[model samples]
Target: MNAPRTVVTDLPTRIRRAEPSDVGALALTGAATFLESFAGILDGRDIVEHCRLQHAPSVYADWLADDAVAAWLAETVSPPAPVGYAVIAPPKLPLDDLSETDLELKRIYLLSRFHGGGVGRELMNHAIAESRARGARRLLLGVYSGNARALAFYARNGFVKVGERRFQVGGNIYDDDVLALDLRA
Candidate 1:
């Protein structure tokens, strides 16, 4: 039997700056989106362990408490459920000439069910706008090499390849392409 697909476009969602009180929501959304995005590309055990530590609520609380960090959460209006999120912090990508004004787009994760309904793009726009407002002249991010959809998203948003790094997830390491966006443009 075929089930009806939910029309994400009809779902009302709002993107807002994440506060300290949103740690739990951000953590849950982050882990859920990460798992859904990488379940097929990454090992199950690694995904579970990685999410347990990296997506912990404490981690998000720390980010929210940091003046130098910024995060935004997207949530449905009626049910008040998180659908996506984005976070930016000081530049973490490997580069010899990174400036003090550069910032990193640590992540922009949206649930797969929200794909094609502009959630990802809205999250990215929030990241970019927040970065620029914070005086960042450039923005950097690392994306897994195998995520063609993510790669295309970044490319469409004016990000260009700058370098590569080995990102560790649990006990495994994967190649990631570092991309940068010139905010001065």
Candidate 2:
């Protein structure tokens, strides 16, 4: 009898709540992923300044310490690396007829290598669940209007474009599409 071959499946990446101790890694990953995704769309100086101000470890440390903010991180087991992260908090942009229970999906970014590997989906699901658990009736997010891949991903996950806003990076202004999903529906 011929020996039978065993089929193996890759283990799922781990997603968990990020802690203050993770600020350093989160900042690095945030800068790397942001540049990977948007560098071509922004000027080199703009990208550098944006990363320095927004993705600095001190900024992440502040976010991690905020009681109202929530963050989740995704990690691969094979080599043990931070592959993705998500941040959720109260909405910053004004919406007409806003509800008291609305929350914002401030950001969700993943390493390009991890794209299409279900890590983004897992991180999104975690954010949605956390928002719902905290009594949020809806979740909103702002994505770069030119980022078709992210727009499509958000759409597939129940987000619908509801408005537009200006996003500033350094001295450059870019249009962003605001998307929202009603969690109570």
Candidate 3:
């Protein structure tokens, strides 16, 4: 369960579980995608700092070390690898805080260049299937309110607004809308 396992080997961009060894690559890709996609939605300085802090090798290594999380990485080695990635956690907030059986979509991002080629959807499918397989009743995630493209993608994938919160990145605060998908429904 800890090692990378291919889910779609036929497609040039294959999907697989992320392992400890792929931590750095996963973090780098995640940060790069965030930085590129949120460029106009976020302050340039904040985006730069967020990317730098979140993609640090140590940060990725630490996340990989956590026992509560799992990630999947998509790569197209034959056609140039590093396509996208998805991270998930089982109700990361303390259990006492909420009664819902949920899986947090910590992150699901694809390189900007691969935005409309089904890569993002593929990554989302991987996360959703994995969450369902793990007995998750629902899946939750937060997306910056200003990121219209991401919001639209999630809505198209069956997610609906469930809540909202302010996320602080660098020195700026951004409103983020929480979305959820009921797996059992």
Candidate number that wins on lDDT, 2 or 3: 2
Model 2 TM-score on a 0 to 1 scale: 0.91
Query: Evaluated with TM-score, which candidate comes out highest?
Result: 1
Q: Can you write out model 3's per-residue Cα lDDT over 1-185, one digit (the tens) per residue?
A: 11222344355677788888887788778788877777666789998888788777777677678876778888886875777888888664323334356889988988766666677898898889988888888888888887777888999999998787788787899888888898998
The best-first sequence of candidates by lDDT reads 1, 2, 3
Model 2: residue 142 alpha-carbon error in angstroms: 0.4
Model 2: how far residue 54 lies from native, Å: 0.8
Estimated TM-score for each candidate: 0.94, 0.91, 0.85
lDDT tens per residue, model 1, 55-174: 999999999999999999999999899998999999877888789999999989987777778888898999899888988989999999888888998999999999999999989999
Lowest summed lDDT window (length 10), candidate 1: 1-10
Report how far off residue 98 is in candidate 2 (Å): 2.9
State which candidate has the highest lDDT: 1
Worst window of 10 by summed lDDT in candidate 3: 1-10
Arranged by TM-score, best first = 1, 2, 3
